[model samples]
Target: MAFGADELRVLRRALATVLHPMPLPDEDVQDCLRLAGAVDEAVGEAGRMRAFLLADLARYRGALPGSAAGYLELLQDALVGGYDPVPDDLAALRALRHRPVAAALLERCRTATERSVRSRLAGRAVPAPAPRGRLLALPGGRAADGEPERPKTPAAPPGPAVPPERPAPKPSEVFPPRRRPVPPVGRRVAG
Candidate 1:
């Protein structure tokens, strides 16, 4: 979403406040709040538009070869809006690949789909195996036939031990001791 000049100015001031914080004047605070609201509204509007575009694209896709031009246009717009082409989109584009535009879009969609798949795969973490409970072996434990059991292979040595993290210090502990502690309310100190 694009920000207007005034919005940009307010945003800059808000960011500056983060680096060098002090009490913001009421007017500046109101401007920041208004900017935030405008941003939120724009984001919501964009989401709605994207949803409408996808629905229109689906309708055009359902129409098949008859709606080729409209479908292609919508698909291109959807791509620009960060919509990843699904299997249906790929199949539709492939069917229309005879046309130069459709062929180009098909290749583009294929590359985007592959990149999306790779990113998803890379993001997935391999789950570690669950720890097994300790097996109890009584003094007389042996194979059912009384035959001696084979010895199991030795486990690999563990890596270096990491120290447990210390809890965060309280706000009072982190802040420097007060130069002059304020007297309690309704209990003024005598000079």
Candidate 2:
């Protein structure tokens, strides 16, 4: 969880770069800051990986490029990268009455989310273990279908419970419990 001084410095720089421009206004900037904070806290330093994507959002806003379509595309890419800053950025933009920017960013966020999901599925595609291979000839390598054989290892039995050893009490600790209050016998006099 600890970031080296250099890494922390870099994070600070990145945050500054992402936040410096007053594209929207004071209130919107505050909101964006809040959103960015939550996202940074939630994702930690690794979240910096997607920081560039958020910066791109700023650039997209400035140009008002491709009519809202361009903005949307960028937002989508940012969201697809799994960075929470996109939605927050969109909300802030909307609150500022930048409808076109908001709408475009939202669409992009949605599209990016969808594309990211699809890409993940694609990555998991893992071509069905090619039809044939020399592995089939090895023992336990293939079944009757000539498919590559897979060896199954039996699950191991539960290990013994290890009881932590307690250190013996020191001499002073043992004597404290044995001491009992003794009344001053002879002084119990009367009056």
Q: Which lDDT values do the candidates have, in the order given?
A: 0.67, 0.45
Residue-wise lDDT of candidate 1 within 1-191, one digit each (tens)? 45789989987887787677555665776687687667657546555666777898899999999989878878887776557888999999999999999999999999988887786799942221122222222222233335665464444455333334544233233222324434667966799
Residue runs of model 1 more than 4 Å from their true location after superposition: 123-191
What are the per-model numbers of colliding residue pairs? Answer: 0, 3
CA lDDT for candidate 2: 0.45
For 56-144, candidate 2 gives per-residue lDDT tens digits of 66776666534345555555554444444444555545653356656666565556546656756887431111211111111211233
Error of 1 at 29 (Å): 1.2
TM-score of every prediction relative to native: 0.60, 0.23
Which pairs in model 1 have colliding backbones? none
Residue clash pairs of candidate 2: 76-108, 141-149, 142-149
Maximum-TM-score candidate: 1
